[model samples]
Target: MLSHLNNFLPRQSSLLMKCNFSKMFCFQCEQTINGKGCTAKGKCGKTAEVSALQDLLIEQLKHLNSVVHHAKENDVKPVTTYSDHFNLEGLFATLTNVNFDEKRFQKYLHKGEKLIETYLKNGGEKLKSVLHENGIQTADFSYSKPLKELIKTGKEFQIDLTEEKRPVTFTKELIMYGLKGGAAYLDHARLLGYEDTSLYHYLSEALQKLSLPVSEFSLESLLEFALQTGNWNLSCMELLNRANTESYGHPEITTVSTTPVDGKCILVSGHDLRDLKLLLEQTDGMGINVYTHGEMLPGNSYPELKKYSHLKGNYGGAWQDQVTEFAKFPGPILMTTNCLVPPPKKYSKRVFTRSSVGYENLKHIEGDDFSELIKVAKKEKGFKNTKKLALKDIIVGFGMNQTLALADLIIDAVKEGAIKHFFLIGGCDGAEKERNYFEKLAEKTPKDTVILTLACGKYRFNKKDLGVIEFKGNKIPRVLDVGQCNDAYSAIQIALALANAFDTDVNSLPLSFAISWFEQKAVSILLTLLHLGIKNIFLGPALPAFIDPSVLDVLVKLFGIRPIGDVDEDLKLMLKN
Candidate 1:
């Protein structure tokens, strides 16, 4: 209904104007369009109204941040209840395909309005006038009216990203996306009971800048904010790394079974370890075997999680393959977080969402109660018979603590030329054919080279038997799996340790990043790399649709960023560098 409604109305038609649909535009993710942006419905299947609502929620967060800052400046301690966490949730909800339900966004908008009202009411006239002068009128906080009123409010905040002078908009979007990614990481850490007041302060400051009127925003300011976003992202990554490690023991290189055992099962998807932990506890001794799916695959590496014998190995390849994979999955599937696609009718009733993940009608776990899911799993026809294994084993774990413990061996391998180079071929995997570039790059990176990968991108070549090499009598796997996407933080740690051991900067190390990006999390990780001054990174399958050529030119000049070319050519180029 969302996509067809937008399609039926022709651009510039009277009906479009009457419904206020002409202001709609979305280029937030890759695969939007080569020329025309996705103005009606996103290629990822989000509707114009959904996109507009996302923008409205972001705008509301900015306003809320502005108020928070104004109250601080006036020495008024604005009462805090949900403002901080809500700011993070609002941005994360906007991430591609994370939350498509309009009702969910409506609740977020209403909550943000209440936070703003609390700030305004407590601050009195002085606070109100301060925000008004900064271009946030009193009526801007009126997001509580109704969904229709909120939908109409989206028009004024529209930035018209399709404008010919796109570099400015592009840069703003890059920073915003990074912020979204940062918020997601923050939320994860916060869930694990980690808190940093200063990080929250910085987040509010960044959002406040984004709340500024379009006329006041400058290319230079946005670019500066983008770099600040990079710094903030680094902190976010550090926080999540700490949270994950403290919650679970530091990961050790552990081999995970790719072959499923015959039993009733629940395929747990997405990136939330806490959700997976709760399900594991609830399903223990209940006869429902649980397997990690997609990003959740890395859960096997954690000692706290792996102790549960039923928390079996990983199932699918990547998030993009879920529609088919979920359908084929015989048992109930629980999406713990994002990176979810709409399931097919055959499996829709059996699929459930928890935490931040939500769909129009998919069942969700409330208060971590997965009893119904366990019941369904017990009743459903699961993997009754084991099939021939396509991928028998996958080497996971290899977090910072684990990888760094082998520093001396790695250093020795480099000195003796047993390890010629290190390639961090990591990031989110997509359905795009060009993603095959990563597979070729990994396959061709000489046997002596150690390939360190994290996130779903590892699926590109993870199943292949890239024979191990012996270093100091150690059989080191050529392809090292470094946990989930958040584990990119661990990869960063390994790079730093390698740099420190060699008495040189990470830039001077024989390391390169050939990253495959699809969503905001990848953007945040890339920014973290830039913040650390690591250069000569190769990025593809097609650069983001939001980046203008001129802006990309700046990235190339400043960071030595290059697009991935022919597989062989890129391989040769990386080696030569």
Candidate 2:
């Protein structure tokens, strides 16, 4: 089937990207509708087989979501933060780069567990019509499946190892990976007593429905789940935004260092703002410095986080660089969430996992055990001070409250020609060589441009000397580092504001969204962009796996989305458009 579409595939995608799905149709994850963009193989590592399975899995999840949504809406069990947390784990597992630790089957198992429980009460005979069964011998796999099995089956839903060919090159796989990050973040927020509305139910429902056998599910239904996956993730991040702001205060302009002081220290990374907060408390005046690493750089923006005297500096660039950077840092690292690549043996023992983040042998600090971290900090020497590395006291904690306060001024400045463009140059970061395109793109963006970035993607150029812009007496470079990947919502809001100010559509604004995607968070953000009808935004370094040729066509035709090319070319295109 892909052979026929080969004629339509981009010349660059002229590789062996075939996968068996149906007799007449072969899918390489999310290929372009007419085969113009989806490289024959999924940009994500999802195999041709896993590509097929994902469709089926999402089929199951949609069916499951229908029933679950109805139940929750009807006030059946009254889903809470806990349920949403677990839902995030499963929904995000199917996302690209996240949850690689668990098997794809584990995801199915988790979904199975929920389906069985829901089915037992609703009865297989009655709901079986609406709910497609996997045809397994187990009477109630979703109901009777053990906790371990839940995880195993859940991972199966994550991706099929048998058919999920390696060398994961498709964007779908990375999108899946990103979903896991979002899932983990959503899960953590739940653990800390945060709850989202329908997003949780939709996630569980999608996961549960994705298990349906081919004959039992419809393609339209599958597509619905995919979009719903994006929609729900948006909700999850919205909750995260609220939780982060209300809990840690909104992110403001602040400068953090990649260098740590020579003294006892704890390095915090991932998107868990709360964990970082707690660590800050635990290390307060305790002779331990808390160094932010990877995604944790945004933690410096929160007033609640900055108030910590020991919350010192950042270390390294992004998550992928950890293998090398962690080796040199003289402190214990606490990974609060996803993007945890295998640590080199030298520093593996020094790593710690809190909450749902776990590795096979990596010691995890669970329940409330800072004793291990404290002991290590006392034993090791952290950076004495960050005098040489200090970039200046950047104004950090700026949430919507702060941004909105400047709304009038920002609008006036735009009117006065001081601020010509608002560039959202952020997205997920990866180790891929193609990623350098973003660095170059950022370098070439106009000097008058105000950059709003978030996620690990910002790390690529955050350290660059972009210089300051004149904004209402403040001469700070317009490069604003918003918080984590999910915080893209802030960017969206800003766009909407500008649109309203100009009395025009969002696309009519002078702002350009140059996004770099690596995982599901990017996917969700992209979906939200489409949902809002934002168009011609540049996306890179690749496309997703699950986007079938037909679906990609729909995206391009309906939303005008495109993969980013050479930075110079892309910049010219953006400027012209």
C-alpha RMSD of each candidate structure in angstroms: 5.5, 6.4
Q: Per-candidate TM vs. native?
A: 0.94, 0.79
**lDDT of every predicted structure (CA atoms):** 0.81, 0.62
* lDDT of each residue in 104-200, candidate 1, tens digit only: 8899988888888888788889888887787677763578778877777775666544454456766777888998999999999988999787888
Give me the displacement of residue 208 in model 2, in angstroms. 4.3
Badly placed stretches (over 4 Å) of model 1 are 1-23, 161-165, 214-217, 387-391
Q: Report the error of model 2 at residue 406, Å.
A: 2.4
Candidate 2 is scored at a TM of 0.79
